[model samples]
Target: MSYTPPSWSPPGQRPPGPGPRSRRDRGLTALAVGLTLLVVAVTGAGWYGYGPGAGDERTRAADAKESAAPESTAPPSTGAASPRPSLRTPRPVRAPSAQELAAARRPGEAAAWIAADPTDLPRRNIRVDGPWTVGGTVVQALYREVTAYRLSDGAEVWNLTLPTPVCEAPEHAAPDGRIVLALASSGSRRGARCDRFQMVDLRTGKAGWTKELLRDPARDTPAIIVHTAISGDTLAVAEGLGAAAFRVSDGSRLFTVPTENPGRCHPDRVAGGSRLLVSATCALGDDPRTRYSQLRALDPRTGAVRWRHRTPAGRRVERVISVDPVVYTSIDNERLTDDWRIVALGPRGELRRTIDPRPKGFEHCVNVGIGAGLQPCPGVVVGHGLVHVGGTDRAGAYDLATGKLLWGVRAHDGRTLTPVGFRSSRGTVVYESATPSRPGRTFVLGEGGAGKEETLMNHPAAAAEAEYSTMAGRVLQAGGRIVVMPSFVTGEDDRRQPRLVSFAPAPE
Candidate 1:
């Protein structure tokens, strides 16, 4: 063992303990050892993971963390954000223009309108066959005659021939695009029987059905009766027998309510809608007298009393306020010393508001001051929030809601005026008119009649007024335009030129 130990030291006089080492390598080694020591010190001082070689270590650790996660092209973010929707603005309705208003103010322009034309003229007989404002597009028996010119201009759209000649302009409806017209023949039937009925498919110039009706030949003759109302596809008819209803669709009889004295009760309908207010009087027997007059709402579909009301024995005078269900009748009972009773009734004929004339408020005092034969005064023009009533002598404003009296002013002298149309737009009350003094004029009043009355675009008095003849006029709103009825030609009933007048405000 002593001989083997001597052999290693004999060749270079150095043991094979340390490998070959240069000065630069020995320096790097010393530097790395020093850096390791420095990193330990820095880590102890809370400066951990921050150093020259430590950065490489951190990068490798970051690479390892990134590789451990699922791969995704999307960049790292806090969270997803939902897209906000865009806001849309609604379009505004356009106001009328001044030129349009001026056009409407013209007499010729108004007659051309579909609805007002058929009723505006003064002709003895009119044949209305068109889509009208009141009845839409349906053939009708107008008071005036129809012509080829009217059809060409789109004024008359249908050719309706009644199965029996309908003397009065029958009520018509275009329900489900089917034209239905109510008709009545006075003596066309055998005997004194008069069948009042409806003809359908009038828009297509075809007749659908004819239902027989019984009405007093005296009260509901062709000259006196003007119109009948239809509601929800049902038409109400007043007959000498009693009151009856027929389905407007098929003209089929639904029901009938016979009066106590079927012959004496002359039935009249309320102004609008499909309800009837019957005034039953006992005129059939020898010592004829008015039996107890009762007002009842007859179903337009079935001849049943939805509601019934009893007034004092006399003449039953009925005036309807709202036609849907509630009915108001002003009965002047001759038995009660001509006491005027304003009775309100529900659709079921229940009493709602009873206004007695003997006691004021609900009843108004009847002021019958006949300076002469009832002179035309400014009529009670009611619409919007204000009630505009005027006569040639005076004009006044009343609140329509509360019936509160408002301001008053004297109007035109020797002139009878009626409000053709009223519009409360742009903080003002505009009154469209047909007056004796001025045949055509528009009165613009300040808000609530604050300012004096100002007349705009007044036309000179027509020559026809000298003969006490006046033009019948009406205003209608349709197709987004204000249309006036055509002015009637004076002194010449043969002149059949009708035109539609229209109006719109000036553009802003």
Candidate 2:
């Protein structure tokens, strides 16, 4: 018999279903319950992907079952217990070494060896480490950590240490690998100051700068800015109150964009070079309570208003900035089905094109997981000429120049998927498949979502638990390689370590 603990539930709240459940629902419910339970303890290396109490539950349950068993002694046997069988301990997963990695490299690889050679493919180095966050802000909680890797052959490289015990997730990394921005909480009881911003070194993991974020006291709850995008050497921070930009090199105040009214806004990306695009969702007036959402582009250098493309007031624009020249996002209102759209903007914030996968009514919501927006969506990466977006139900490739959908495929639910770090030989989209029962697998989705789709990683050891407590995100480096931080679900005192996994593409 297998040992399965009761499912994980939110504090004080019961699991989704009511009372006793059927046999079939038990497994699914267990998986879902475990997902939440494991999420809290799952770290790259913190607890071996299982929380501290995970094995305890199994051991306790096994002991209870054993106690009820009938015992019989062989006739005339000595009054002593039988010796136990030798336990086959699980082996540790070893990552590829730096020397083994460099030996497989090719010549003339552009910008971190990102050009395609195709001869040497799927070189990987896997590691297990503490937990870390991507996209928001990097936090210092015990489980909040990052695992950096090489894309060419999945070689584990570096890891980021959090400042405190809490986490401020990272939205994205700077293109030049000089600075990283994160969202964090001050952990105040009075809610006096909750969210914070941090600028850190990409290579050395040192604090480049830090700032306390606040919102207008007039309306809504005061909150700190969460999302950011780096353009050139500048960083743009967004909040519900307003948006601001800072020099990435020195964290110097570059400019500020005040809000028209005290409303919610978030910075998503630095469009082209001169303009910054933000997702604005705010109130029409303080009275009867009306809301409006739109995409606003501003000059990051000087904080000048460029343009605002208004959309339906009720449908909040989730992310106004994107990897491509245009921004992409999805909307789902009570009165309407879920729809996807991309808004292309010129340097002056002129609307160039609007591509809508209108009325698709996707069953998945962006809120379900990280980077789950109608726009960029999760795992969809946009480069010089193409856009890639993937979800549990489907994955699509599109041409950035024509707003045309190139190709798409169906896949499992994934936490993070982006192009291999930086550049390499082929136009590849690397993605991870995270599930409740299996060790998440990574794939190299090539041009047109083609090439090898589902390649098994054969991670060395079984995760401590079947579920992942924390979120998993990835980054693309210069050489067409892949970097990924695995989900963490363990405690701080486990022998099994956590880490980042890097996979480098083979030479052409």
Candidate 3:
């Protein structure tokens, strides 16, 4: 579906925006948006610039947005602006709600959540993944089942149960909503190999080809599973020293990652999404046994190496933050648990910049799995030509191109900001923040992420505890609702608290 950029104006503001137009005018929005960025870049305080054209915030933001999702806003080659699914990512058109959010303000009374899932106590601690929003459907997988719900209201849409709990899922799926998931080899979780697989259409609850990934007699063993990522039509699964790509629609093997050397160098981990990357560990010069890790950009369909980047000795690529412009963290082999450095790579797999979160006073979330665990950093929001990092006292946005500090905002007296996503589609960012006893708050920063955050919605105190329960889960805004769900559901009692809750503007 062609993207319908949302028309948004912050609270207490009446800035004018262009009215509905033809495809060409819509495409020109980017240029107009860029001009706006230039003005903000020069005037916005606490912002920084570097490299050629330091004032060209428009170009940088545009480049970052395009790089994250290519051809997102480019005009069609010939046809008049039409609803072309392949041309751009689909985005919902959310109405401005500054008035309602302000008019219905309440001190408490569960004002935060208008809808939620009924609380339940499951016997075991089931591993949960997702809250992925697709075509207005919010989906989640836990134990042996995958379920979808309406984004507007937490109402069930459909459910698909698997023989075994899902062992792996991609961060994003094909533009058409197709996804391949790996299941356990057996019902028992102990020593289960995630070889069984299935493809499902996220939009509809239809299941596609389901089969077990065959281990190559010549290359792979009976064991498998880590992270699964999809670029276009190809899905790549990575494990220890093994990586393979397959056709996304129907489970067809594309290619197997070959070992670089008989035993010295091998594939270690892989990451996918708009790009495919494989990390390899190589032991060279046997006398002292020098070791290092290499990141290789591979063609999603052909499995051909497009480029390779070797890290300094003793540092291995630990987690992949993104693959398009390649963001990752590497640590010294000896200091595996510490010394985490966030790095960004150019399109050519060249090292672009690195940020040490410790010195910057920011922290990233490590949402890795028990297995391959690649592409695991979810703590920071990577987009809009900047990476949003979180620090206890304040949060900062770092330029992905220059790695320079852009702007930092101190947390409110009782709340912490978590950059959710660029929902406004106008360069301003939306954030969800709250304290344990305080109601959740939704706010949007000024255009270019430079101005003070204006409150968009505020939940009532009655829902504070429920909102806090999902603090560790993914928090994002969809269809004008703030969704907060646990990343994983454990056996710990919920005390009948809602596990998945959505907060919307209070009814006026």
Give lDDT tens digits, candidate 2, residues 1-508.
Answer: 0111122122333322223432323443355345434433343211111122212322233233323434323231222112211112322222324453244323321111111111111112111222233332221222334433334433334555554322323344455455544433432212322344566655455566665443334543434323456656766765433567777777777887665543343232233233356655455332212454566666666767767765544554545435336555534322221334555555554556655532221222222222211222334555666655544334455565676665544432332233332133334444443332232334545444434354423221122121121123323333333333432222222213234444333335
TM-score of every candidate relative to the true structure: 0.50, 0.54, 0.71
Candidate 3, after superposition: displacement of residue 338 in Å? 2.9
lDDT of 1 at 407: 50
Q: Compose the digit string of candidate 1's lDDT tens values, residues 292-332.
A: 45555665556566665665454344444444444343433
**Residues 160-203, candidate 3, lDDT per residue (tens digit)?**
87776676778777878888887777766456766777898989
Instruction: Quote the lDDT for 69 in model 3.
Output: 41
Which pairs clash in the backbone of model 3? Answer: 108-461, 112-460, 143-165, 365-379, 473-487
Candidates sorted on TM-score, descending: 3, 2, 1
The prediction achieving the highest lDDT against the true structure is: 3
Instruction: Give the residue spans of candidate 2 off by over 4 A.
Output: 1-176, 180-192, 195-198, 209-225, 261-275, 282-290, 320-323, 333-376, 383-386, 399-404, 411-478, 487-497, 505-508
What TM-score does structure 2 among the candidates reach?
A: 0.54
Task: Report every candidate's CA lDDT.
Answer: 0.36, 0.39, 0.58
Segments in model 1 whose C-alpha atoms lie over 4 Å from true places = 1-140, 143-165, 170-207, 211-227, 260-279, 282-292, 318-321, 325-410, 413-432, 435-437, 442-447, 450-470, 473-508
